[model samples]
Target: MIPTNLVVHQQSKVLELTYENGSTYCLPFELLRVLSPSAEVQGHGPGQETLQTGKRDVLITSLEPVGHYALKPTFSDGHDSGLFTWDYLYKLCENQEQLWLTHLEKLAAAGLDRDAPMTKQGHSCGSH
Candidate 1:
């Protein structure tokens, strides 16, 4: 389902989406950045996904519509490859809690802090 309205609340750091069915989801900027669907984050194959860290302060610098199906967001962290499709976004809204929990679990398993900076090797830097 497509969103009827989308509002970016800079103060709250959330992207609020309102659907035709009157359902609204407030997605945090951090969540959106860490969970980006871009290949840079998701990788091109299974087990190659890059775990994101230090995104608690990431911001949506700009957002643009992509054709009639998706949105392209340029994050303050310089991530702009993820094209958030309508269906994908709806799913994110529906499954936010579970997805977030899973992400946390993965981070814990990797012994990485959500607010820790990533190193050049795409892993969290313990020095920081």
Candidate 2:
């Protein structure tokens, strides 16, 4: 379903999408940034996907349409390569919970945090 409306809630740091199917999805800015479909994040092939960390405070700077198919979101971190198509947005909405849990699990296993990276001494090095 195509989104009928979109709102960027800066205060809440979420991008809300209202679809024609009456489904409203509120995706966090950080989630969108980390899960970006950009080659920088997804890489060029399978198993080359990069795990994103220290993105808890990241925010969307802007969003522009790419034809009628997708949105290109500019992030504060200077990443703007992702093309979030309607189908991909819907998929993210449907799998948000599971995906978020999976991300958290991966972060934990890697000794990382959403807000910062772990150092060799087990302390937060910084947001990277």
lDDT of each candidate versus the true structure: 0.90, 0.83
lDDT of 1 by residue, 26-111 (tens): 99988888889988888777898899999998889999999999999999988898999999899899999999999999999999
Q: List the residue pairs that clash in candidate 2.
A: none
TM-score per candidate, chains pooled: 0.93, 0.87
Error of 2 at 64 (Å): 0.3
Worst 10 residues of 1 by lDDT: 119-128
TM-score of 2: 0.87
Per-residue CA lDDT of model 2 for 12-53, tens digit only, reads: 999999987788999998888888998777876886666788
Give the winner by lDDT: 1
